[model samples]
Target: MKASLLKEEFKTNKYDEMLKDLYEDASLVDYQKDRYANALDKFIELYGDENVSIYSAAGRSEISGNHTDHQHGCVLAGSINLDAIGVVARQDDVINVVSDSFNIAPIHLNDLDKKDEEEGTSEGLIRGVVSKLKELGYNIGGFKAFITSDVLVGAGLSSSAAFETIIGTIIDGLYNDMSIDMVTIAKVGQYAENVYFGKPCGLMDQCACAVGGLISIDFKDTEHPVVNHVDVDFSKYDHSLCIVDTKGSHADLTDAYGAIPAEMKDVAHYFGKEFLREVDEKEFFDHLADVRDAVKNDREILRAIHFFKENARVPQIVEALNNDDFDLFKKLIKESGNSSYKFLQNVYADFDYKHQAVSAGLALSEIVLGDHGVSRVHGGGFAGTIQAFVENDFVPEYKKEIEKLFGEGSCHVLKVRKLGGCKVVEE
Candidate 1:
């Protein structure tokens, strides 16, 4: 559809159903309508009014299985209402992208090879996704995209994953008949991040962002992960899902994040396996002494232990939520949090103990929620934010108390979005 027609479509009830499905909040329909309208106008103003399509890829929250995805373990994650949205028009030769912050330079389609200079830049992610799609024998093309996102960056919400998914989705919708599945789109996103964007990331964030809804993912086969949806409306449990950002600096913490999966793999290597998931739990426990000695790091052994327990807990939590057992679900969440804090040991970086903002956030969450709610280290941990399941009635108070320590507007109450990366329609 033309950008002008799409902007007019938003002025009526044309897109209400689609907006409702994506956001799951009736109250947010108008806001999304305005968001799409504003983005369309910007697209027209920047690239002229050509035929364009709208796309949205959700940001994700890790509900269970902290730091477990890299080891081919299971995890439970959800696509949040926060997302990266794009108004894109198909172009013939070169890809150009402009976001609210800055403009990515035009990327020539013929030059899809990984460029060392483009590392860690949006240009790299675009070229990388295109390159991976071509490598996988999928169709590739060019587009001019006006992108925007509400997903808080560096707040453990997987903003980068959302961006990557959006880019892949736009290409899929435009060139590949939208035939690429979400998992493949996710893998493309991960490839872009890992090889092109210069970040070592597991598939969990991209998978969740691309797949949508609350899902349990088993990565025992990294190339072909098993994803299953856990059908339940958590809002009905009378709890609000809140992610409290601690405003902590993630600078110079790549090594800290890298150490976790490396150490877990170290334990796996001792057992002549590549990932801890391949090792039997009983064998690990029986040969603890030898394994510990071989790894030469007690922390590595402890982290491996955490990987096993946390992996098992993902399915248990999924079952609990499926059975409508919110109480048991909450209990399991606390257990996951405890395991991550003690055994996984990613609550705070050892190098900077004095600035333990994540630790402080978790401590404050414990104090505020006490028994009624549950809080845990969110996402990659070591820094950033913490996730909390706060009782609905107490959300205002909970948000106030937590934001008092972090800052006002630091607490974000989010909803699980149903749709992942897809082209929006007006029907």
Candidate 2:
């Protein structure tokens, strides 16, 4: 379809069903209609009124597991309504992206080699995705895209994963007949981030963003993670999902983030294993003293303990959700938060103890929520956002009080979006 025709299609009722399915909030249908039409106009202005495709990839929320996925542990996560959307037109040999948030220079498909200078840049991610696709014997192509994202950056919503998912999704939809499965899309994203973008990240973020819905990912088998869609509705229990941004930059926090997996892996190395998942929980607990002496770091032992407990806790969470046990689910969420704070020790960076936005947010959330809700440090902590499951009745006050401290518009109440990365207007 031409860009102009797609804009017209969005204005009509043709795409309403698809929009509702993607966003999961009927209230946002009109908003999405306008968003798509405006993005189409931008695409027309920049790349002419050519035939184009629309795609959206969701941002994920860490529901049950924290800092456990790096050890190939189990995790419960959900894809939220917030996402990165793109309007793209297939070109010949080069790829160009103009994002509302930043600039990405053109990347030639011929030069997909990892560039040291491109590390940590968008160019690296783009080139890396294409290179991995070709290496895996998947079809590849070039496209110019105008992308926009609502996923909050530095707030632990997996914005970077969403961006990567969308790029791979565009290529999958445009050239490969959308044959790439969500898991492969996620792996491609993680590969780009790890090998090309220079981030030693686990597959949980990308997997959650690409697979969509409330999902439980068991990475014990890293190559073939077991993914199951958890069927439960938060509204049925009179609770709403809330994420409060405490306001801080994740820049320069790479070392803090990397140390987590490195330390956990160190503990695994003590037991002659590559990942913690390969070690038996009983063996780890029984050999605690010897492992502590070998690793020489009590915090790493504590983190290893957290990983085992949290990894076990993920299944209990899935069961609670499946059984509609909201109270038990909330209790497990609270326990997970306490474990992350006490054992995982990621709530605040030790070096910058003075700047403790995440800790502050968690504390304030406890005061406000008190028994009616649950709060925890969200994603690669030590900065950025906190996750809270607030009673629907208390959501307004919770958002208000949190924003008063963190500044207005800092708190976002979101719904779990059903779809992950896919072509938006397939009709």
Candidate 3:
């Protein structure tokens, strides 16, 4: 169907069934329809009413194992319903993308080499994904797309990863056989971020956004991570997952995020290894004094300890979830938050004590939920959002209270989506 025809169908309620199938939330059907309609309108405005396909890639939440993925550690992550959506139509040789945010990016697929001038832009991600796909012996080509996202910027949700995955999905659906696994798409996204975007991020964000649902991922082998889907029925427990955006800026925090892996690797270098995961916990503890002396950073030593303990906690949390032990899971979550605050020391930048939103949010959540729920510093953690597992019935009250501190609509109730990066509309 053409873009114009799709718009007509949307107005006539011809696509409501499809939307229901895609979202699985009857309550969101109208909202999803409106979002798609708006994207289609924008596409028609920019690229004309050519026949286009729609694609979606979900944003991710780091459920557990904070800042451990870069060191080949274990983590539990989930894909939230928030996502990036694209309306795309195949083109001859050039890929043109106009997003709701930022200027238009046009990339020539034939000349898909890293451009120094394109670093830190969406064009870099597009070219990187294309280059990676071609290198992996997969099909690649050009397409014109209108992209938009609900993933909040700088809120710890993996928005960049979601956008990268959206690109990968568009390419897979349009040119390739659409047979590339989500994990491969995620790796391509990570490649884009690391080499093209100039960020030394781990595979966790991409994997979580790409794999979808609640998953237990062990990155012991970076090339082939072991991914297991954990069956968690949130409705059964009467709990809701909420993310509170504290409106903290991530500006000038690159060094803070980068230092985590750097210092952990420094400790590993002290023990003749590459990552903290390779060093045994007992050996690290036994040589703690020597390691501290060699590294000469007490914070680094504490971070290493956090990594080991946090890694150990992943499986226990998974086990508790598998056994339907919400209490134990909540307990481990609190412990993880405490470890992140005390040992990892990423709650706030040392210099910015005046703006401690994460600390204040955690403290408030503890007071509000008491022994009924769990809250923690979410994602990269220096500044952004906090994750809270709240009782379903108490959600409204919790959202109301939190919003009072962070302003209106700061609290978002999220669901774990089952699908990752994929083409939502085939026609």
Candidate 4:
């Protein structure tokens, strides 16, 4: 499920295309064949080049479901053309990470097995991946990686997951026999983000970003995620999806986001379970009174309800998509967005006032198109963009409403990309 409708054009293996872009872009300015070539050159200048190879991956978009992966629910997602490319030159038993995306110091694996609970950012993320790989008995050695990316931050896309997966893939390509699977890659990436990055995040971002394409990831069991690829072809219908950029400011989402999954877990724990999915309708209703009594916040209760309901909606949407019932699917998205606003507590986060983006986008959209326009919160739903199914005739009207709020380039009209995920080219 690429964000771009031009699936035929996007190279199946994003790394290969990114590599070419890196070479061509850097070469236009006299750049090396690989962006990290300079870093490898520096490493050799310091020590010596032994056995080194390069590998990479790209970011992904949540095509259908939102926040469902954490609850062991369903999510329709896939990789995007934009990615981070890393060229690693393996060396001694040292694991060094050189990143162009993050302008920080090069990371060296001295005590690679240790976790730094203090400064939780790039280094911890890198070390986190390395630590997980080492724990998994993966052969990890010294390598210099240069990274570059097109994935934008704060856009509701999983950029961190993309970087981590690329790092893991680079490591796998360098040492392992190229027998790495997407699930393993996803876990290793999640390990880095959760333990290393210090973000109490869920598996959705890592899975979506790692697996790529339109996949239904079932996390009913946290230890194993069952990923089912779904075919999403909406071209037969004349409708299009335009994510409205409600030109609203966003908050620092770190701590605020940390609260979401934590709180959900709390609600589930009230029913004696790991996630809302584990608690059956009977168990939830049976313990509803206890849950309400135990939790003081009303929004918490509402969010709990939203999680359960949204979880159930994933499969329905998948069925609707298969039947080409865009109308039904469109209606479901609106329902999900409304629930997120009313229950999930993400509709309007207090941090930096991010909720206004979704709210304003919906307001403006409704003003222009009476009933044909369906707009709701997209992605994490606190801000950024809202998914809107607009009438083709109302394109100009939709653009006007969107531009007035988010400026000229705020709203994006996108079609579904079909080519799932794969390595584009070796050369």
Candidate 5:
């Protein structure tokens, strides 16, 4: 377990053989391969090693539950083929990190275990995690790393969460020797994004991306979320899961995104509370006027209300899926959509594009699939992708119509792979 021994193993592992064996046609998607290649090239250039090992975690599509995660509420989500992958070669005392999509230099691994926000840009997520690992009293050896992500940034697919999860797993498996629990590692990734990277996101994305599979997260106490993995067969079902891009502009929506959690905290303060999740829906609404006046921002109260309703819907949605009740699921999906639009109000800024994407899918699902299923806004919902549970029989026809609106490849069929944070084929 010496650092030098691990470094030697990293350089000698049959990575090509491993990748070829690991990347079954079903194992990795095309974009992931490209990102993995890019990361490998960076590893070769920076660390002078053609033989760096790889660890990967895939991005997720929000199957159910939207803006609710911010309040530490429930979310039903699953992982997709779009993954964030990394290649690591052991380096003595200094771990150099490089990312493919962003033009950032290899970060020093030694300094990383103690990163400062001013010194680190987006890369601070990685440095901060490493730094915290050491503080947690873990044995973390240094390595040169190259990371690449094919998950579309700002697409609501949570690309950053995917990356941070994989990086945390890499540290736990390769450096810390998997001493930290998987959930704890996932939390570290979330902390890296929230505190170090300055992205005001919640734990659902990181947890969903890291945990993989179809699961409902009860963020009633975000620090201790309750998770229940659902067992459902997506392939046997006769329908397609589609994403229709709303094409709603997110420009100038930065503060609107940040304001959600901040205002929720303000709402909590109105009642001398912590998070809006702590309050009941009727209790929250019975005092809507007072809650509205207390927060002073109509939008914040709206966002907080959505959290209550959405968290309540999580169990109902999961039950619909478990019982194969398409009608129930579809109805719930539409209700969730309306809540995001009317209550959460993310759709108000640019209603037209959101309409084009969401309304079109809703209409199409009704027309084409008959009584098959429903569609809803996938994630934060400013304007990106809409998640629809489609009828398997009419999937192609559904994709054809939706693609005409959002371009080809807009709709993707994904399966739940709940392997959790894994490090396979280690050198």
Candidate 6:
């Protein structure tokens, strides 16, 4: 279908069935229509209503295994309903993307080499994904896309990974056969973020955003992560996954985010290894003093401890979910939150007392939910959002209480989406 036809379909009810299938909620029909209409209009305006494809990539929630993936550890993560969508049409060799808020120039695919000037921008991610795809022997071209997202930017939702996966999905749908697996696409996204975007992040975010569902990923081998899609339904237990965006800024926190992997690697280097996963936990304990002296930072040792323990916790949580043990799962979630606060030390940035929104939110959740829910520091920690699992019946009151502190609509009630990165509608 051309952009014009797609717009017409949206105006009518032709896409209602498709939207129901995509969102799984009949109530979201109007919202979906408005979203798709805006994308279609933007596409028509940018490229003059030629035939185009629509793609969507979801943002992810880290269910467990906080700060463990960077050490080549395990994690249980899921793709949320929040996503980044693109309206794209194949171009000759120039990739032009007009995102919602950023003013990024179009990228020419013929010049896909890394440019220091483009680091830390959305253009870097685009170029890096294309470069990685081409290097991996995949067909690469260009497309003009109008991208928009509802994924909260600095709120631990993996928005950057969502955008990268959207680009990868477009490439998969357009040039190459859409047969490229989600894990490969996720790896490409991670490569782009690590090399091009100048963020030394782990594979968990990209994998979760690309794999979808409630998955337990074992990054024992970073190259070939074992992604197990666990069949755990929160609705069955009257629970909802709620993320509270405390509205904290991630600005000037690169050093804080970068220090996690770097500190873990520092401890690993003391053991003559590259990542903490390679070092035996028993051996780390045996040489605690020596390792502490070598790193000269007690916080690094503490972080390494969190890495080992959190890696071990992933399997336990996976088992609980597999056995339909909601109580155990909740218990483990609380434990993960405690570990992140006590050992991981990521509840709030050090020397930043002015912004302790995460800590305050967690404290408030503990008081409000009591024994009915579980809350934790979400995603890359330091500052941003907190993840909470609340009983469905209590959601309205929970949202009200939290919003009073964090402001209205700061709490997002999200579902675990089944699909990851894919072409949503094609003509």
lDDT of 1 by residue, 139-225 (tens): 898889899999999998999999999999998998887899999999999999999999988999999999999999999999899
Write down the RMSD of all candidates, one decimal each. 1.6, 1.7, 1.5, 6.8, 4.8, 1.7
Clash count per candidate: 0, 0, 0, 9, 5, 1
Kindly report which residue stretches of model 2 are placed more than 4 angstroms away from their true locations once superposed.
Answer: none
Q: Which residue pairs collide in model 6, if any? A: 1-427
Residue-level lDDT tens digits of model 2 in 226-256: 9998977755888888999888777778889
TM-score of each: 0.96, 0.95, 0.96, 0.78, 0.83, 0.95
Minimum summed lDDT over a 10-residue window in model 5 is located at 1-10
How are the candidates ranked when ordered by TM-score, highest leading? 3, 1, 2, 6, 5, 4
| Candidate number with greatest lDDT | 1
> Candidate 4, after superposition: displacement of residue 270 in Å?
3.6
Clashing pairs in model 4?
A: 1-213, 1-214, 13-423, 13-424, 26-31, 52-90, 78-213, 79-213, 94-142
Model 6 off-target regions past 4 Å? 101-103, 289-296
lDDT tens per residue, model 5, 1-427: 2223334444554244444433322444443344454555566666665445567787878876777777777888877666767777666665566677464545565566434543337568777677777777877777766677767776788888887787788888777776777667778887887678876677888877887677788877777888778887655556555666656566667776777678878887777777877766677778889988766788787778777887789889999989987677778878988788777776444424544455555555557655655766768766676777777666787788777766788777555555556675465
Cα-lDDT of candidate 1: 0.91
lDDT (0 to 1) per candidate? 0.91, 0.91, 0.90, 0.66, 0.69, 0.89
* C-alpha RMSD in Å of predicted model 1 compared with the true structure: 1.6
Q: Against the true structure, candidate 6 has what lDDT? A: 0.89
Q: How close is candidate 6 to the true structure, as a TM-score?
A: 0.95
lDDT (Cα, 0-100) at 159 in candidate 5? 81
Off by over 4 Å in 3: 17-24
